[model samples]
Target chain A: MVTETDIEKLALLARVALSEQEKEKLRTDVEAILEYVSDIRKVSGGEERAVPSLVNVMREDGTPHEGGVHTETLLSLAPKREGQYVRVKKIL
Target chain B: MSINLSELTIATARRHLANGDFTAVELAQSYLAEIEKKNKNLNAYREVFDDVLEQAKGADKKLPNFRTSKLPNLCGIPIALKDVIMLAGKRAGACSKILEGYVSPYDATAVSKLKVAGAIFLGRTNMDEFAMGSSTENYAYGVTKNPFDESRVAGGSSGGSAAAVAGNMSLAALGSDTGGSVRQPASLCGVVGLKPTYGSVSRFGLMAMSSSLDVIGPFTKTVEDAELLFDAIKGKDPMDSTSVEVSSSKLQVKSLRIGIPTMIRETEGIDPDVRKNFEDCLKQFRDAGHTVKEIELPTMHYALPVYYVIMPAEVSTNLARFDGVKYGLHVSGKNLLEDYVQTRGTGFGMEARRRILLGTYVLSSGYYDAYYAQAVRVRAKIEQELRDVFAGVDCIATPTSPTPAFKIGEKADDPLQMYLADIFTVVANIAGIPAISIPSGTAMREGKQLPLGLQLMAAHGREDVLFEAGKEFEKLRDNRGGV
Candidate 1:
């Protein structure tokens, strides 16, 4: 069962805010969903998850495009921007 | 002469365009008129492009060069795009308020290829927020109603795309499928939908819902039209390392074996009419001199459970980018932490946030090993089981959906009941195989005929087998004459 505290922590980890009402509603919904999917616990496949060789899989001969070719279009989408860089609140 | 839009196919459209039966501009006007008439009630398209006539006029110029082989098959055809797909300079928000009004910076690989093939974009269609839900009710926009019955839901996350084709608003449409997003809606709308083999079509432009299982598919009026759209959009791209080349195939399959999975008999929630229609379809196949056998995939039932775990885990990871920084809706809070939370809380719909929370929970420290890790193991087992089953049969057949289109808002409040709609369709995604949903027949619902679909799944890189089987079944369905 998912507790209120658990849903709160999940909200924090996922960077989503929730009200008391949404939290209570989400708690029950998550609990029911987990119960429905509880059968996944019975799986005993002994092997670890497969990891493909994505590293070094890129082609070498393809020509790289010029840098900042789309800087105007890319920066235009930002909510807040100054010059070329996107402005965000200070971390510290 | 007024063109009968419902009688049109990509093949017929191409032939007519070549023979000068009608100009591309006239064709575009026809579809635009249809959308203007039907879309208000059906809620099919999110935005019908303003440049449709211009695009068709350009194709008209190319028609003079047809004998040079420069003319493409789709050169004047009108197509709808799911809102999740990126077309450069066009808005694609995945039907979520978070990315509302966010214009795409570049064309998705498929959209770029479609432009090259001479297809005109009709516009973006509606979908579930972030392609998360089984029905389009979760969209920030209004729910997409069934074209046949306004009281019923057009099955989703690609509901808008399916409805567009089914209602004849567009000749064909492109949709992204993660766990039956394309096939389910196609089934409910009584149109043909194809989820090609994983990696067969490039996903460079589609919004990520579950990267592992995500694939872009087509919704069309006929299986042949589905093949045509798939052909235009498929190929490897340097931008997407996971994309692979799907060769051109003109396969003529003869007397192939089709498997009816043993789980079908045991699974619950299947409507009685759905089962009866499936049996009638099997009987037709048997009388046509094809082998019909019941095969077992021991881990078949585990597919839905594993999907719920793995999908959210990937979703939480993929959706983390929408932190009000680079693009989309931004809400300022006291600090950076509050900024992220507030923006996501208000921006995401209930279904999107719910999946995000479920995904975050499974990947959390204590529960990761139990839920996410275990799901990966079971997923692998399911893949192996499907491989074993496919070695014996060329294709696996089942009802595309357990039931036909349900009334709008019927399952809106219950997430679990909505999730059950994808139970049969998720197996193809889990195994990374090709699957197609063809309209099998219809069932009487509230005195209206609601269409049902027969889903055929083939082994990996075996879309040719599916296309052949689907076309053959279409012949039989035409003779029977119901849907």
Candidate 2:
């Protein structure tokens, strides 16, 4: 069973703040969902398999000139921006 | 006389445009008028693009010369897009508060192809927040009601797109499916929806939900429209590495063998009306001189549970990009970390939060092997079983959903109950194969006829089989005077 403390820790890990009420609700919902999905435990002894015919596609390490078409547009979507850079809180 | 927008299909509209019966502008106006009449009540479209007529004008210029000039298939057809699919300069929030003000900087690969095809964008459609819920109730915007019955849900995460097509607001719509988001809603709304092979369609510019499981597909009134949209949108793209070349082969309906999963049909929670409809569909196939046999997919029972584990884990990771810094909703807090917590807590809907938390739990250090790893192993087993079944059968058949559209708020509070809506549809995504849902017939619920769908799944890269069988199924139904 997922306890309130465990739910809180998960919230912290997921970077989502939950109120006391929401956390309590999530605790129950999470427990119920986990219980339902615990059926996966019944299946045992299968080797890890990757999708067949899939290959690692590699591309050259340089940006194409056509890719720059969206640069200014992407920068404009930033909520907080300075000049051409996206602004964020100082990590230091 | 003005064209009837309700009965207008891509093929018929194209022919009319070619004959100059009505201009593209006239067709666009007819749909816009219909949307105006029903959109407020049905809540199918999140926003109707202001430049719809302008786009129609562009298409009109090419329509007259279509015969002489090389014209793409979807020329002048008005289409709707699920909000999760990015269209350049359009608001695509995925119906989530977190992306409330985000405008896509570029078109998704599929959208770009649609533009090249001269298809006009009607607007972005509503969806479950980040495509998380089986019903559109989780949307930050208003819930999209079913066109057939206003009080019931339209099935969801792609609910709004399905509703738009079914309600005559758009001829067709594009929707993303991660665990039946497209097919389930299409079933409930009584339309055709297809989820192509996992990597057949490019995922570039689509908001990631479950990266591996996610696919962009179409919802239309007929299988041919679905195929047209699929052909226009599908292909390997330089933008999406996972995209691959898909080859097509002609499949004869008479020679094909369809597999029916006896185990899944006997599973508990299937509604009697749905079972009846499914059995009737199989009878039609058998009567058409096609062989229908019972095939056992032993690992299918674990598909839903495996999907829950795998999807949420990817969801937690994919959605981590929505911090309050670069784009979308940003809330100030005491510190950087707190800012993320506050922004996400306030912005994400309840279902998104629950899934994220569950994902975090499953991927945690101590539980990773027991939950996530175990789920992966079982997923492989399910895929292998499906591949083995496909070797013998041309396609597999099932009900798109266990039941018809439920009343709004029926399973809102209960997550498990809602998850059951995708039970029959998720195996296609789990096995990374192509699947389509077509309206088989209707079932009476509460004295109203609710639409039920027959789901047909084909082997990876064998969408031709689905389209061939689906068209034949429709013909059989039409011959019987059923829609």
lDDT, candidate 1, equals: 0.90
lDDT, candidate 2, B333-446, per-residue tens: 988898899999999989999999999999999999889988888888888899899999999999999999999989999999999899998999998999999999998877
- Could you give candidate 1's per-residue lDDT for residues B45-66 as a string of tens digits? 9899889999999999987676
lDDT of 2 at B168: 92
**How close to the true structure is residue B399 of candidate 1, measured as C-alpha lDDT?**
98
> TM-score of each candidate?
0.98, 0.98
Q: Name the regions of candidate 1 deviating beyond 4 angstroms.
A: A47-56, A59-63, B70-72, B247-252
What lDDT is reached at residue B60 by model 2?
A: 93
Residue pairs in clash, model 1: none
Worst 10 residues of 1 chain B by lDDT: B64-73
TM-score of model 1 relative to the true fold? 0.98
- Cα-based RMSD of candidate 2: 1.4
What do the candidate models score in CA lDDT, each in turn? 0.90, 0.91
